[model samples]
Target: MSIQAKSERALCEITRSIRTRLQDVYGPASADSLFHAVERLIQRKRRTLSVSAGPRFSEKDALLITYGDTFLSPDRSPLSTLHTFLQEEAGSLFSFLHLLPFYPWTSDDGFAVTDFRQVNPSLGTWQDIQALGKEWKLVFDGVVNHVSSDSLYMKAYQHGDPDAEDFFIALPPETDTRSVLRTRTLPLLHEYQTTQGPKWLWTTFGPDQIDLNFKNPKVFLEIIDVLLFYVEQGCRMIRLDAIPYLWKELGTSCAHLPQTHQLIKLFRDILDWVSPDILLLAEINAPWPDNVAYLGDGGDEAQLIYNFTLSPLILHALVCEDASNLTQWASRLPPLPAGTTLLNITASHDGIGIRPTEGVLPEEARRCLTELAVRHQGAVSGKKNSYGTVCSYELNVSYFDALNDPAVQEPQEVQVRRFMLAQLITFAFRGMPGVYIQSLIGSRNNLAGVRKTGRARTINRRQFDLTEIQQELGTPGHLRQSVLSEYRRLLSLRRKEKAFHPDAPQAVLDLSPSVFALKRGGLPGGEEILALHNVTNRTVRVDLSRYLSGERYQDRLTGVSYARTDLCTMDLTPYQCAWLKKETLISA
Candidate 1:
């Protein structure tokens, strides 16, 4: 077939798939109008991209971008924030910008997507998102992992509407439903029920977020249409949130199941067949084995998987006061399939609880790690002294409480130092590190405000205040300056350092209980960089004669050069980090 013929065929198939999918969700007439809206959005995107075209986009050069309800500033300008962020921090490192679920919703930080076709007015309009997509690559949340029980479809389902009822997963009669559904994961929601009978709805997180049934082919097709619609709306990437829970099996956690991978692979294949430019990121909150599997053997599944393990490793090293845990984790990493990447981050809006690193630390140390996270989170809400005991380890806040906390304040310089250090470690470590916008400006958690609002997670979703951040930035010796400086330093090094890019795989060099060391090679230019971190509260020395045979190693961070074994007995200050680069083939 001619190239033009192939393009036309691909477009036609996508149109047909989208129409059928939308008809299943909405009626056929609504789907038609939605399809037209999508086409207009895509045209706008294409026109936007036409103005400043760079290198022609290839399939391999895909980026997974994401935004959330609280991802925006109070002014609700994710585009301007993203534009500045890409220009200042990311530059050309990323080709995609995923504006997370920005649509209007009743609860769960907009995860309960109310409208599939329109942008939430609280966030910018759909036009703003389309315009942003035009200038940069774009990704959006499928968020079909679960829908709000109060969602339009769910309401229809409750009202005995035949069409909308099939769109959601409903349990059997009350007695049969008890065998299949779970009531509450939270402390407060001990019981829940649906109108279909006395049957309890299966809620993994809460009563609000209802898990979708992927066993039903209708559900699969409906979500696939959502995917196609976003692609038509100019999204080049789609984030599959809470993917592990999509398919449930008896007597198991029902996460990251075999079918899950198959389904994601199917989505990947479809996108490849349709646009080739669009990518899927699987939000599978699983361990390394399960997480890595999402990448598939041929790199044909998820293009990006969250490096959920690595983020906690950064925090653990800081709190344990040793870098060894991080280095140990890095040592065990297997090589990833080509054309795949890990999304690494330190802190996010999501509550970082004890589950992520439960068994990773010694029992005695776990308490300290827990305390540090709580305190750090507490600091975000401007409630450093409210907790009474610093190491109390009280699982006090709820998910919603953290999101809505109005007092979510920025941390002080000392606190920001520890936070920024963790983030720097994230940046220097292997995989693509993500800097949460709140953390970048040293934004804090909201304590009193959340308490006032009676929402525990409110602090987690507080809007970014640029004016407050600007005022804080004006303070010469503030935490904001310190964070900004360290971030600039780390990001600048990442930009210049070839070892920290997409292709570099990490290897562990030292795994002592107190210190951690990592090696990064396979740079685009084939150069090698060695990073060593000291996690102990006191100085500790490690012999580098075994790792380095050269007479000297150059410190990438501090411009100092040392003879090979000089580092063998050299002591590192508490929480100090070193990045050294050398040619692999040095002649004697």
Candidate 2:
């Protein structure tokens, strides 16, 4: 079926399933309550499916930038840099920008919600975000996955206020809940004590980030109100953080439970009925097949799901010096639901996590990938450790590690060639790519925060210095320049090529393990473009002569052209990418 038809069918299926599920959960007599919760979502999904077929980048509600604990002011604001940033990177391609949770919280990089209604004073005022929202696309987070232990609501729960306690999921005393539902961090929960003895808290991330119990209907109602409030403030998209772990069940991995799907569908339904324009993006980090579940066989559950598989796979291909990982990962990629899209990106606020595809990657390959990372960082642990002391001036260091690595050479240029190529593949893939704030400026982990606090991620989260970027503009061909320049090139290419648009169909082409290829844009009279990427360090001769007969090839990035029979053995340099287009086709 076509993308539109598929989307429509998916909407119908989701609406039907939601209605049935609600009835089952609340009984037929509770139809009003069910309708009250889901009617909007059903209506919104239908409306979203009926949009005009064109480049969605033109109509995107927002362009998300990573806004950590502090929103860097232009002189100080990394986001205000958008005024110039939009001209360079976005260039009217997107209207919305998602500022990942800049609110005060304890763990999970601010996923632990301490305050729902207010923006963290450390970042800026609600007024600052509102003003920024006015000029550009505005998207604030609805980190409803869990609340912080220090949250006001949690405090109320601890003080025995029944009404406030109702907002959270506080465990019963003397109960051990750790084994079934695991927490990301240990020490915080390792020694737990409440009014009840040795009671376990539901921590999908850390003890500080206590997972809220969605089972409690009250939790649903309150969060809904919170979502509507943000929507009312002109926010276009609300990113549901750590969505899969929202609902927990026993004897199963608490993440991505059936109820989690139901909860998202319900949220979508409500939004549809109330505000059809608002988009709900799910941060469900799972493997390809499993991640598709969040799309609800169409566009019902979430309008956008994070393409975690693509980013990691691209990184894997780059780091491992083999495009096989990219091809293998792409082969397993599931289609997106109609009307909905995937939030694709290589780097974000958080460290890379590669556990989702364990089922598909060979044990040795996984071990090798792990070893490569450790070897780069000079870390001994095999645990995908992000905290390493590898001080190679050639390697890119996260902000946290940059400070800790005393060996960092001054004028350290972040080794960004492979990383940029990795991100290029990510943006060109079948999804809406999300470029993190740090990636734009090639910001490395801040070692200053690490030296001061001894925490790497937090240090990496330090506000950036745009002035320094402009002043020390010392090196012309440095990694920072390469990153900024390549991003512009790739994003520019994506805009010119219709295949990179949200509506375009993506097909993985047959190629060697060292080469990754995909075809996009078959618009009539508009030339079809084929993308080939070489992930190997050594040049690989690709026999694409078989597929190029009677065709002309043009490079999308540099407008370089070649005849179909010009060559049989195309030599690709290490970490190089090429876009081949027909000379007969119109160039954007």
Q: Give candidates' CA RMSD values in order.
A: 8.0, 6.0
lDDT over C-alpha atoms for residue 400 of model 2 = 21
TM-score (C-alpha, index-matched) for candidate 2: 0.82
Candidate 1 least-lDDT 10 residues = 380-389
Error of 2 at 455 (Å): 3.4
The top-ranked prediction according to lDDT is 2
- Candidate 1 per-residue lDDT, tens place, 529-588, comes to 777776555677776666775667778788777877676666777556788766343323
lDDT tens digits by residue: candidate 2, 1-588: 897798678667656766776665445776567555545533443433322224334213225566643333444344345344444544554556777776777765667778888776666666666666676656778888888888876776666667655454545544444334332323213234444334456665666777677766667767877787777566777888777778766546566777778778777776664555667887755556777777785577788877766654665666566667667667766566678887777656665445555565666755654555444442212121122222111122352232223344533332455566666676667767787767666665565665776543453355645445544333577656666666666676576666566756778876788888887655454446678887766687788776674466777776777777764567777667887777766545
Worst 10 residues of 2 by lDDT: 385-394
Q: What's the TM-score of every candidate structure?
A: 0.76, 0.82
lDDT on C-alpha atoms for all candidate structures: 0.61, 0.62
Question: Stretches of candidate 1 above 4 Å error?
Answer: 1-96, 134-136, 172-200, 250-252, 371-417, 523-525, 549-551, 563-568, 583-588
On the 0 to 100 scale, the lDDT of residue 235 in model 1 is: 78
